[model samples]
Target: MQRTILIVEDEDILREIMKDYLLNAGYRVLEAADGKEALARFEEEEIQLIILDIMLPELDGWTVCRRIRKKSNVPIIMLTARVDEDDTILGFELGADDYVTKPYSPAILLARAKRLIESRYSTQENHPYEDTLLSRSVHVHIPSRTVTVCGEAISLTHTEFEILTYLMQNQGIIISREQLITKIWGYEFAGDDRTVNSHIRNLRHKLGKCATCIVTVVRAGYKFEEQI
Candidate 1:
């Protein structure tokens, strides 16, 4: 079945443009002119992802994003006109998987949309039902999706968990940022490699002293070293 996407924007021209591009990309597109209509459509449809505009009639995108995050982790990409860093960070804090600044490229937006959708579905597909045991000072619990470093549970975000899990599952194999982005972030990452670097930084921060389990090869990628 073709994945469904809900686009909430008040601008008719832009909305239609986005819809056309997404449709041609082989996605089923749904459009709402305002947040009220968007919420109504969301209730009525099995939407796989949402493209939300920050400025909307009756209700704003931030509120809509908050409402959706309360009940679902379905990926959302926020559309904003401002270049304010706060807006981007706030969107991420509100559970937006990504953001697009307007007047945006339809192609870039489509690329991001494809990436987010594939990331969500790919993680679901790659989720290991079977368990694995790791002997490193860190013990990763696949079923619970948790990592224990020296008997202390290390907190990790969903993305971090997925990245670590993928690495540990394929221990000793050098994996590149491109591979991780493709496998973990879902689609071909068109953005800077810093995105991957930032996530890895956060993962290591959470890992604390046990971060050494994840080895970074210079100019290469990363690998999970089995502890002796």
Candidate 2:
């Protein structure tokens, strides 16, 4: 299946550059000059991935990401020129799956986009059963990629879901941050331990009463254990 990628960048030249790369790579490309337009195009198209620019006009990328995440868990790769750690953390908090700084190679961007898109499809195709993990009051259905805490459905980003799934699959093993970064985002992922921390924080917050199931090991990593 030919995947569609939405490029949400205001700069005409940059947008064209990204679109050209994706098109040449055989993906169906859509363009949006600003965040509002990006959201509209997202709602209208069967987009598998989104390359969103943080400095967009209208609603801005943060707003766009927050809104879309509330409705869908489609992988989002945020593009920005800023190298501020806070900005990257904020993007993660808003449900972005990946981050790419500006002045980057289109090849790199394409690689990131491809990884996210392929990961999503591969996960679905490879898992066919209603394989589920239950601990405490949290339940995660692997095949359907859905989670519920205390019987209430919870929304999670792609990365967040993957992390939770991996942890729950292992149950009591302490998975280090490096291991998690490699397993979930691949060896090429640019972000470090803080990225994993941010996602965990978000995941815990969403888990609410069942948050105790995930425990942070001192000077170690994180583990999933049934809380008594």
The lDDT values for all models are 0.79, 0.90
Most accurate candidate by lDDT: 2
lDDT of 1: 0.79
Assess the local accuracy of residue 50 in candidate 1 as a C-alpha lDDT between 0 and 100. 95
TM-score per candidate, in order? 0.65, 0.93
Q: How many residue pairs clash in each candidate?
A: 0, 0
Model 1: lowest-lDDT 10 consecutive positions? 185-194
lDDT of 1 at 110: 93
lDDT of 1 by residue, 1-228 (tens): 699999999999999999999999999999999999988999899998999999999999999998886666577888999887667667665666677888889998998888777655654347554465575577777655567887887755556767888888778999999898787655644444665676677677878887787899899999988545
Question: What TM-score, to 2 decimals, does candidate 1 have?
Answer: 0.65
Please state every model's RMSD to the true fold in angstroms: 5.2, 1.8
